[model samples]
Target: MQEIIVSWSRRRADSPKTFTRRWKWTREDRARIEFYRTELAGCISSATFDAMLEGVNSESLLPFIFCYTVRLKDLDLGFVEAGLVARSWFCLGEGFENLRRVLGPGPRDEGFKYIEDEVEGEDTGYNDPDTEPDDIYVQEQFLTKQMPAGAEEEGALWFNVNIGAPGNYLPGLRGVIRLQSRSTIYQFPLTALSGWSAKYIAPLLFLPNLQELEVEGHATIGGLKDQFYYPLSIPLQLYKGLKSKVKRLSLVDGRMRVDDYDALAELTGNLEYLQIYHTYRYEELSPQEYASIASFFRKNNRSTLSLEEICINDIPGTDMVDVN
Candidate 1:
């Protein structure tokens, strides 16, 4: 966190309040993990684990299999719960969109909207009679902010054109593939393994030169727009589309699940090597936590067969200590 504070502002890195706040959050995270570890230890044997999954009553399929928690809705439905905050760097020509279902769209492309267009008889002022059909435009001034009110969804930023009168229509988005490709995420630890990685990973998968992906930390949120894109959602497509081009994947302190490995099994089939290193001490983790890690790999056959080297608690996939 000293590095994080320093990076926030080199001069202000020494501030006591920032450190205090981070320390506070870190303590909370540690408490949360401890509670989760207790929950995991009480779970029934791995044999009956799937039976428990069937009993979850929530309609939303995601039960979030945490680095500490053991649960998943299904592997085939492609809901292998988001694992952690991921930090990845992509090399260009940085796009590899060969799949039948492509990334919806970005700032410069026309795309989906959260709300449907007006019915045939109804009128929405967004449609301007004078604008050319091919040349799309919207209220640019309205879009310069974080997000224009109603634009929510995967393709919120996607639009074909940027020309539009203020208040006439909403035109642009805050974050985009073009901007993201150059800037990149994972620069900061907190964001890389956590918030809104799918937005960036979508563009990275489109890159032709893409190969390796390294996930650091027991990340929480997976998809930004929908919360199931990384680890499982996009990687599922990577196995089919990227073929042998994308191979090497390293989980530093991964607390992955069967569903996760099941989704990643296809890609792991081509994996040739495994390297493990302890970024932090293993004793900090309880026996149950170690069991969680073992259970993750044990669940998937394809993933188990693919690894060349692995050790229990030898690598730093969970970096809570450093962050805290």
Candidate 2:
């Protein structure tokens, strides 16, 4: 089968032309067509996903748009150029909605079981008395044989089974791709994204397991002052919503009012680590900026926060001058 990313892009080809289209079809599609003309219907991956995803991390799915979704435990848009990050998040937010329509809303119950037991040639139990033999043949061929590539575009479905539950029925960890449940995502760190990227933060609620979040200065909730960006109440609501389980929060570069911390302090119940990071130029920081940054740590007594350690610009490997 084609890599899911390439297949995903190709799937969008028929979608009403937008920007004349940047992403489309795939190498595999053409490769399949060539093979068919040359009499070799298709090829196969000798290497299996079971071998590949043994210890997959955020880096494993790099450059794949799927990496940006809930499958990734940590959502770090800071790596991309700030301009492109907006598009990345927007596409991701939209992708989730599209997938939700297929997978259905609510939590994804399918466990991400990368490791699978050997079940080759076992009776899959998919061949129920009610199931037609033709349906059974399709299921068996999909798991056993290599079909032609462009065949899918021609309305040829190699494998049609229940989306979530593969079980021993689907039969191999070799080419398995599991869509992660809502509980898979935990850490979401959003840098101060400009323009529309901040608006897409509302989708974070989709990941019910998100715990650690890093909020940027410009992306802070609400516009209590001029220095901060315009009303960012949408993301603020995502972070501070009653259902949120955000534990470790790092506040970076917010030049807002002293009272903003009061709201943030109450966002999480057992906020283990609250770190304040000044991401911009340290020397040029204004007096008012310093107050906005400092006041959060100072006035936390009133909030129901069970903070363990409060870190303020605790950069590693930096020398400190003694003031004694």
Q: Write the per-residue lDDT of candidate 1 for residues 1-324, one digit (tens) a residue.
A: 000000122111113222211011133443454554356443222212221222211111111231211221111111111111111111111111110012122222232222333232121233222332322223232122212122111111111111111122211211111111111122222222332223223332222333444433332233343233245544346335333323444445432333443444333333333332234421234545444443343333234323223334553324312211
lDDT of 2 by residue, 1-324 (tens): 222321222223113222121111134533443443344212112112111222111221232233123234444433221221122222334522232222211111122211235232222222222222333223222222212122111111122111112122121212322211111111112322222223222223223445666544233322122233434443356445443344555655544333444444434454545666664442234444444433443344224332235555663211212101
Which candidate number would show the highest lDDT if scored against the true structure?
Answer: 2
Query: Which is the leading candidate under TM-score?
Result: 2
TM-score of 1: 0.28
Off by over 4 Å in 1: 1-206, 218-244, 253-258, 275-307, 315-324
